[model samples]
Every structure is written in C-alpha cells, then in structure tokens.
Target chain A: MKIPILRLERILLVSIQVDLTDNDAMQFQSDLVEQVAEIEALGVAIDITALDVVDSYMARVINDTASMVRLLGAESVICGVQPFVALTLVEMGRDLLGADCAFNLGQGLEILRTRIATRGDTRLSEDENV
Target chain B: MRMSELPPAQIPLHETADVVTARRAARELCEQLGFGKADQTRLATAVSELTRNVIQYANHGECVIENRSTATHRCIWVQVRDQGAGIANLEQALTDGYSTSGGLGAGLPGTRRLVDQFHIESTPQGTCITIVLTKPL
Candidate 1:
C-alpha cells in the first residue's frame, strides 16, 4: 500500500499503519524522497508505532529512506520503535535501523524542530519569513 | 526434524505478501504458545526474514509452524522449505555483511541469534530451514 505522507508546516509526517510488502516499502521510499524534495521539507518524521515486526528488508528500507531524506537536506527521525521490536532488531544485527530515532511522534517532532532551528538558515525562501 | 503430533499451521509462500502472512502466522502461533511479547517479536522477525529469503531466492516456499510442547519442555518449531536453487555459500551466507541480494547481509546470521535452535539444509534442488524457540512450561 502507498503510505500517506502528511505535511505539517515544514515537516512531513508518515505513519506506517500496516505491514508493508517489499514492493510497497520501495514505493514508499521513492514517494517520500520525491515529496521531501518537492516540498522542500525541513524535516521528516516516520512513525512506525503501528508496526509490530520490522524484518531486515524493512529495516533496510527505513535506513535508506532516512539517508535519502538527509541527502536532500532534510532531517529525519524514526519514531515509536516498540520495545520488543527494538530488542529484536538489535539481536538481528548491529545498526539495522541506523536513523535518528525517538520514543514517539511527539518526541520526533521535537527533535526535528530543534534540528531545524539549530541549522537556522537552511529553511526555504517561502518559510524564511515565517 | 522432531515435531509435534499436532498439525502444523502451514502457509504457502508465493510472493512478497506471503512474507507478511507467514510472519503473522508465526506471531499468532507464538502468542497461542504462551510466549511473551519479546519472544513473539523475535520469532515473527525471524520468520519474516526467512520467508523473504524464500521469495527472493527460491521464488516459492512454504512456512510451517507447530507447537512442540512435551511433558517437560515447551517449544515452538518452524520450518520453511522451498524447491528452488539452494544457497551456494553456507559459510558466507551466515557471515555478517555478506549479502548477494543487495541486502544488509543480516538475514541468515541475524535469524540464528533470535531463536534457540536453527538448522538449515540445502541442495541444488532446494533448501529447507527449521528454527525452534523453547522455554520451560
């Protein structure tokens, strides 16, 4: 399924509510990256709270997506990694999901805001006035 | 290949979606087997990686989950089998950072660490992998 990416100010929000197939994960990656570039988003928060399982493939997709977003000059944070999921991912490998992470969407947005503010002048011309 | 007398919950793997089906079956079986949330996630993640390998390499496979609780031991047995070209390098495949599919190379090795027992057999004709998680009843 194509995951919805919502825009809130200069940040992009994506909540993955279902288990994504390999194809869907890849599609989501491209969609988010393209959208980030298109909107000149300052940050992206990918909330995976609803995901109960994150395998190696999905971990790779999330890691790659985060890197791609950062490559586009946007901050990215992965939020709501469940306790069990976190333990499982670590057991699976070292650095399975190597993106910045938060306990939840709220903390993710806070980190994004702090990061964007710290960077200061990177905001788009349209957002600069605000 | 010691298994329970009870019929295993079998799910056929033909495509990517089957990965999720197999994972859910494993998780549900774990829950029914009375595993805690941590164990449930571990087994589910392990099943997910195994099923994905089946699709990516074998093109087709089947996931079988069974309850193997004995009088003194409680265990969950899972078997994933495929009749496609088997893994060529068992050693390298188990090594971390060794992936042929542009993956993170953590699938096989990572799965081994997640469960209590892991066994794999492969031939040019096909491959079969069995993993087990156990706890005191």
Candidate 2:
C-alpha cells in the first residue's frame, strides 16, 4: 500500500500504518523524495508508531529515506519508534544515522520547528519561534 | 516436548510478500500463545529478518512455526530452512557490519539476540536455522 504524506504548512508528515515489504519501502522512498522536492518542504516527519516489526531491510530504507530528504534540503525526523523496534534496531547494529529521532509526533514536530528556524526557513514565524 | 505432537505451520518464503505473510503468522501465533506485546513484536521482527534472508540470499525457502509447552513454560519455535548456496563464513555472517548483500549485516546476529534460544546448521547443500522464544512464567 502507498503511504500517505500529509503537508502541513512547510512540513510533510508521513504515517506508516502497515507492515511494509521491501517493494513498498522502495516505493515510499521514491514517493517521499518526489513529494519533498515538488512542494519544497522544509521539514519531514515520518511516524512509524503503528509498525510492530522493522527488519534489516526496512531499517536501511528508513535511513536512506532520511538521507534522501536531507540531500533535497529538507530536515527529517523519525517519530514514534516503539520500544521493541528500538531494541531490535540496536541489536541489529543498524543505527538510523543522519536522521533525527523523537519519542512521538509532538516531539518530532518540535525538533523540525527548531531545525527549520535554525536554518532560517520561512516555516516558523517570529511569534512561534522558540 | 508437549508441542512436539502438534503439526508445525509451514510458510513458504519465496518472495517479499511471503516474508510479510510469515511475519504476520508469527505475530498471530505469538498472540495466541499469550506472549506480551513486546515479545510478540520481537518474535515478528526476528521472523521478518530470517524470512527475508531466505528470499534474498537463498532464492527460496520455508519457515516452520510450532508451539512448545512444558509443565512450567510455554514457548514458540521457528525453523527456517533453504536449499541453496550456503553461507561461506558462518562467523562472519553473524558479525555486525559484515554483509555480503551490502546490508547492515544485522540479520543473523540481531535475530539471535531477539529470541531465547538459537542454533544454526549450514552446508553447501542447504542451511537450517532454529530459534525459540519462551514466555516468562
């Protein structure tokens, strides 16, 4: 299934609600990159809270997706990684480098806001700046 | 020992879709066996890794899931076997950051850490890996 990527202001929010196969993940990478470039988004938040399993292939795909977003000049954060998935990723020795992580969507948005502000992006207004 | 009498559910691992099926089956069986959410997720993720390996390196394979229960303990056992080119270096395959497929090399070792018991037997003719996860009493 194709994952939905929602656009809010200058941020793209992606919530994965299925057990993604290798093909699904590959498609997601391309789709996300394309969307990020199309809208010129300043930040991306990928929420995997509904995912119960993350294998080596999926982990690598997540890392690659984050890198692709950064290369496109958009900051990305991986949000809502469950405790089990976190433990498995560590055990597998596959760290999601170059991608910021948060406990949940709220934290993820905060990080993205800070990053966008630091980069002098137009997403956050002066009144909302923290 | 008690579970030896029951037939194991066989899942064919021939493609990426099969890997997803296997993972789903594992989670269902884990839930049926009364494993907690964390344990269920752990088992399902381990199953995903092994089944993906079967499809990636071995071309095709099968995963057998069985329930094992004794007087004081109950657990699930999974066996993944493939008839293809076997791993050249078992130790190297188990090491993190060592991958022949340009991956993170976390499949085998990560699987081992997720379960309560792990064993492997490989040869040029085929390879068989077994893992067991026991429910805490």
TM-score of 1: 0.95
Model 1 share of native interface contacts: 0.94
In the range B1-137, model 1's lDDT, one tens digit per residue, is 24455588999999999999999988987887778999999999999999999999999989999898877777899999999999898998999989998999999999999999999999999999999999987
Candidate 1 CAPRI classification by DockQ: high
Candidate 1 on A1-130: residue-level lDDT in tens? 8899999877999999999999999999999999999988999999999999998999999999999999999999999999989999999999999999999999999999889988984563355666
Recovered share of real interface contacts in candidate 2? 0.80
Predicted model with the maximum TM-score: 1
C-alpha positional error of residue A5 in candidate 1 after TM-score superposition, expressed in Å = 0.8
User: What does the lDDT read for residue A122 in candidate 2?
Assistant: 65
What lDDT does each candidate get?
0.93, 0.86
> TM-score (chain B) for model 2?
0.93
Tens-place lDDT per residue, model 2, A1-130, is 8999898877999999998889899999999999999988889999999988887788889988998999999999999988987876776565733367999999999999988888887654324445
- Per-prediction TM-score to the true structure, in the order listed: 0.95, 0.91
Q: What's the distance in Å from true for residue B122, model 1?
A: 0.6
Error of 2 at B117 (Å): 1.5
The residue pairs in collision within model 2 are none
